[model samples]
Target: MAARAGIASSSTTLSPRVAQGGSNIRGEQRGKKRKSPCLSMPLFRSPLSRMLVSPRIQLPGIRLRSPLVGHRKSPYAERRMLHIDLNMEVEEENADAEERGLDSGIDQVHQENAQNCFDADDDVPVALEDEETGVDPGQENIQPWFDPFFDSDVDDVVPVPQENTRKNVVPDNDKRRAIFDAMLVKARKGYLKGHESKEVSAQFSVPVRTVQRIWKKGKSCLDQGIPVDVESGRSRCGRKKMVVDVSRLEDSSILSRTTIQDVATQLGVSTSKVYRMKKEGAIKRVSSSFDPHLTDQNKIDRLRWCLEMLDPRSVPHNPVFKPLFDYIFIDEKWFNITRKTVRYYVAPTAARCIRTIQNKNFIPKIMILTALARPRFDSDGNCTFDGKIGCFPFVTHTAAKRSSVNRPAGTIEMKPIESITKEVIRNVMIEKVLPAVRAKWPREDAGKPIYIQQDNARPHIAPDDRMFCEAAKQDGFNIKLVCQPANSPDLNVLDLGFFNSIQSIQYKSASTTTEELVAAVDRAFEDYPVRRSNKIFLSLHACMREIIEVLGGNSYDLPHIKKGVLERQGLLPLQLRCNAKSVNAAILSLRTMADT
Candidate 1:
């Protein structure tokens, strides 16, 4: 105790006070009172003592020399600085112990840590324990290869970057496989540097301890004589996706696939899962427009009708369809007063749109017949005729018997014709349709054999009806009636898409009366563009071609050849060309049906 700083024993051998001094000091400290925080501290903190003492006992100027770490100077001043750092760590540990609740004995916590320091310096004096033990309080990230230093050159300082401290570094399975493969390579080569995992982590941006755990797993497999694999089962990680059997959709019953819920119910899957399958193109929605069940005779009739449409001049060489410019496509449609569903834009605060009527079943509906002809364009691409013959409503004007809110008694109001017999159709065609055709027909096209093509409805007058022929020939016109095949509405341009286009426009506005509905449909009919009508005629030819290919079966989708683009480029053909092979096939099909 009397020796000065340099005079104190600086040898590697134990001093006489080394063994006796710790026991006496502990005895004296046992008599002293300690706070609850000191319970986490080591019972021995001496360089040679295994018992821990309270870190509060500050040795301001203690120093000692040891055989291990002989590079450090054996000065008491340097030793004091190390003890202060250890005391700060003890305080942190005491704080942690308060949080963690040291239920176990304090000696159980630190016996292993205290034993390692004394094994290296059993003879050194009390002051050099912390320099070797490196007691950091609650160090969570302490691991081998943790502080990666990228060494570039021999003399260059290895820079330590905060590379793996980032959170949420979730790598997918493929990336993890690459990492595991690299780890397996380094691990098989003996892991000579011991920081192989850390280097791999730096290369992959994974945490150091994570890489070590991955390697630990692989090494365990190797020890068990199994091929090492650190990567997870790639697709076996999360909840499995539900598999769908497609045969359930092939049922003819509508309940199996009427809606997504129906499909999901039938398939035994969640609706959202079925919807996801649809989004991923595993399934699709289609409105089935099925073909009519055609008998052998009906098929022959349809085949013959399609063959008849092909121009005789081009049959063997080119097989082009008739221009159908002289043909009038007339079809009857029942126009409703208003659509079942409509859309409107209103203020955000406004209430939803609500409509009312006297009786939904009694809602005003009128049957209107539309007549269309292919518009004639001259060589300069100027329209000579508009192609709109007329749109006639099947209603007669009569005096209202009783007054209502809309009209007074004896007012002449147009009423829908209840019975649409052949007489009514003939009278309307003769009185309204032919007059408009004569008024609007191109002068150069007049006196030509203008064929009025109509569907084979029961009420429609036949081609050879004596009354219609007499009326048709009165105006110096060769207007003739030709009936398309029965139950084949696709043969006409009106039913194919023109009527739908007109209905779509008519439904955009609300019409609550028969007269308004008639006017709405008539407006839609007149406003239709002539260029679109020509395109519809082209589409009609396309449909005719498809009919021939299907042998008169209507199981084919309508083909659109970007007719608007061609027309815009002034390449709009008067008639669509048909395949010569298809024409021959149709002829052969008719012959076979005849022979059978």
Candidate 2:
């Protein structure tokens, strides 16, 4: 009581003479505080603590004892007692938790707490917790009761902050369409409502002028009875096309065009600017590669090879390439156990995967010999023969002679035949390729001859190699090996498109060992659809047609017939029909060369 009296008396400057109902002790305390010049606030001066501690005894410092403040001197005087109504908001962040039977509090989730310290005068929230432990000092957001009237300055109106949007940006098609649709909603027969353009410009992040232009374009289209299309010609309105004198770059060496920087340097511009040229097709990216140099005899031989594949029955008119159902294409390709660059889609929180290999230059790779024949389709397009003879890996199983970290001694392991030789190819053909052919060959054509077409690679054995002849004779199968023309990979079905298709599927799975690599390739080979195999056969026939046209040159682009759409419509041809004149000319040219 004494501390409260001293605190209330020290505030004499805040009291008025109309409330001079004070005792003599109050006068003495007020005089003492003035003379001492060391008046400190009472320990219980906090209104909240005082309210809690002295609930029955009203404190004048907190609430006026009289109806009006300064009308009394004693802290407890109640003559015409005025109650100072405090504008406070009590917020409990525990309603949701309480309903769910969970406790919630300011800094913990296990307990509930209610805080009542939102001050209307200062527009600040006060936390009751003593000592700050990195708590966020609450914001002074004005409460709803006082926000509109609580103007710190009477004359000035506060401006609400908005996001910064760049001016004069041409709106995209979707935004323009939206703006036009909004205008159309309120449009009175094509003219936008008076303030519609401005309103729309504010709604979307677009300029009023741009919005008006879109509205005008839409109205113009609407007047013509066309669908309202306000699509801006943004693609055409951009920076003018870059004029590249391709002739000027003609003399540039390969080194100069190897990189964008080199080309940009020669053209005297930043490398960044060259990408625009690339995008605009003013500059193009081309790969520097080596293709086999063709000789006149090689060309003649390729021409003859195409002439031989033609069906003699259709030689006179509407010549169709022979159905290559009995022809099996065989090729050996080296598949990497895992590529140097493999892509994986992982979650943001997933651990980064680190792939390690023994040696980068010597990444595990194995040679696979794959055999494929034309898939035979019944009248209903149901496949009778899937045409996959087999994919055989040139690997041998041997016991490890020495113990290593990866394996113990005498453990059987699969090791790829690294140095593939003619003998290895010959052995694989007799043991694996020939047997698969005999087993998978259509029963209807059991007595018919089968031919395996191989590239003229060094490792390829002769057509009548002794071991293959012995094995092929045993199955009552007259399977002969024919070599494609030298330097003519387009002549074979596998090289034309089959290998590329299956390899793309093969690369989808990761492989770490030679066995896994072989398994992946075999899986890819079987997973390859027979319908696509038929398309590849047609692609080979298309290549042959191109070869005959260019006099055996492989310079023509692969023709696309939209085979999928055609196949869906049941119009896919069993064999591509060739022009009679083109075939005759090819034959005549070969004869003329033979005479020379």
Local distance difference test values of all predictions, in order:
0.69, 0.70
Candidate 1 stretches with Cα past 4 Å from truth are 1-243, 289-293, 343-348, 379-381, 564-574
Candidate that would win on TM-score: 1
TM-score of each: 0.60, 0.58
Question: Tens digits of per-residue lDDT for model 1 on 1-596?
Answer: 22322221122232112221222222443224321111112223232221222233212123333234333332322332112233344446445545544323233323433443234646432223332333233322222111011111223434234343459666676777688778877765545255877789999988877677776776688779997666656557688876888677787486568898988888889999888999999999888756668777777788788888899999876999988778898999988887656678899899997787777777678888999888877888778887888888899999999999988999998899978999999999888888888888877767888899998889998899898888888668889999888778888889988999999989876786777788788888888887777788888889888989999887788876888888788787888888888788788877988998
Q: What is the C-alpha local distance difference test score of candidate 1?
A: 0.69
Which parts of model 2 have CA positions greater than 4 angstroms off? 1-242, 265-277, 280-283, 345-352, 403-407
Give per-model CA RMSD.
14.9, 16.1
**Residue 283 C-alpha lDDT in model 2:** 82
Candidate 1 structure, TM-score to reference: 0.60
